[model samples]
Target chain A: MTNVLNKAINEKPVTTGMLLALMAATAYGSSQFLAKQIVTEIAPPSVVATVGLFSGFVVLMGLSIGNLPKDRKAPKKAVVFLILSGIASSAGVTFLYTALELAPVVIVAPVSSVTPLISLSLAHIFLPKMESITAKTWVGAILVVAGVSLITIGSHI
Target chain B: MTQAIIFALLAALGWGTSAIFVRLGLQNLTATPGTAISLAVGTILIGIVAVTAHGPTAFNLNPNEFAWIVLLGVLNYVLGRYLNFNSVNLAGISRSAPLLASAPLVAVAMGILIGGETINSFILLGTLSIFGGVILVATGGGRG
Candidate 1:
């Protein structure tokens, strides 16, 4: 473990990846904060969700234009799943905006951050062959759920 | 308050299930294009509804706010996602996921510092547990 940490810290690519992850986290965190500000102070949650996500779509579409043709060559089922995934992702954003509209970012973020746990369970159920769930995952899941329960309990009390 | 938590959990469910879909979809695709396709599709579903259902006047806003939203959109969905994808490829998920998972911490910090929100004891400890748990999960590893 110490060796892995030492190597990750010393290596350039690993360090770069670490930096990028931190940057992405910052962007995500800031977006939530800004979304809260926008929804609470500037506009309705629906408007904020639509405009913000639509703008993201525009940029992502531009960046990914070259790969657009690749989608067609791909299997139809893949496309369908992608579409469904997209809808779910959109719903997630909409729900998040709504939560932000109603509550503080601090409250909403901790609760919503259980996404990994959800993903783990779904992966275990749907793609058991692809995902290898360890005992550590269950341990972590329990802790996260317990934490979330506490947060909910705290909010009520 | 309960409504907010429900919505938050729903958000998690939407996001969580979407990852499975992405995993299924990506069996034949790579990250960027797959994400691009899914995001475009999602935008069409939710974004269009948010506008059309709410009427044309729903999106009314000043130039300043609009620009800020646009910038944030690019930052979070485009740049942030791009960076995360690249990081996963570079450092591997074990190294990257923990950091990526810390996004809530950043939000919590920003909430207290910039957004001027207060936190109680249970909430603080709960947040920490959630953070620690997420780190443990990420380190334990799932390919997606």
Candidate 2:
């Protein structure tokens, strides 16, 4: 069992990665809906974000404790990046909950989905080796932006 | 409406850029540690905001609501984020991002079924457009 798990972790295939991404998306998307429900009862978006994140942090810390020593320490550069990323993530989630409080899940979820467009653009500019903005990427981004615009506009009227 | 849109856009920017950092960080740290550190930091930052905005009472909640929040934390932060880190580690941002973008589609469906959300033609159309765009981006103009 350990060997199989190790193989799965060490030799992740593209299909597995794609599957994981899909699952993550589904879980995240559902959480938005759930969060909308939670916020209706829980006041202050910050509170919701705090509780949810704190809970996850505790669980993840518990899970990582056993592996802490064996794992190679992250480089200083990576630690910096991770800290920045965590700040960004906190900002993103706080904003997301605030938006959910204001708008319906249908509207908020699609708009937030534009993360990839931004992600792709940022990757293209900063991490050129990580991602190249091809024509298809541009076209898709346009579509996503257009779609988000429609939803945003429609929500108002 | 305007406020919501602005905040949502801000979220898009934050989340989008964070993916890059995750990828970069994963290069040096394993997924579990990377997820733990990032989430821990995020939780602290957001917790501070919550406390500052609403006082310590901001953390207060009824039993039922607290239970739900815990469940959401597990589903989203633990399971979802762990998988997300793995995906980025395995597939890179360009390839995995579009797949993750499909979240809104799932949310729309789940919202309707569970949250009693009413969808209109525009919402449906917009959702489809976004999904199509994500697919196009993922497949690289239908190449594969």
Q: Give per-model CA RMSD.
A: 4.3, 3.7
Tens digit of per-residue lDDT, candidate 2, span B1-144 = 878988988998998889889989888788777877888888899888888888997676889888898888899988897789788888777678778878888888888888888888777888888887876676563221
What docking tier does model 1 reach? Answer: medium
lDDT of each: 0.84, 0.83
Writing each residue's lDDT as its tens digit, candidate 2 over A1-157 gives 8687457767776777888899899898889998898887666788888888888888988998998876556578988888889999889999999999988888888877777678777877788776767788778888888787788767866
Residues B62-142, candidate 1: write the lDDT tens digits.
899899888878888888888788789778889889999889989999999999998888889889899989888777755
- Model 1: clashing residue pairs? none
Q: Model 2: residues >4 Å from true position, as ranges?
A: A1-22, A70-72, B83-100, B141-144
Lowest summed lDDT window (length 10), candidate 2 chain A: A4-13
Among these predictions, the greatest lDDT belongs to 1
The DockQ of each candidate is: 0.68, 0.59
Find the candidate with the highest TM-score and give its number. Answer: 1
Best-fitting candidate, scored by DockQ: 1
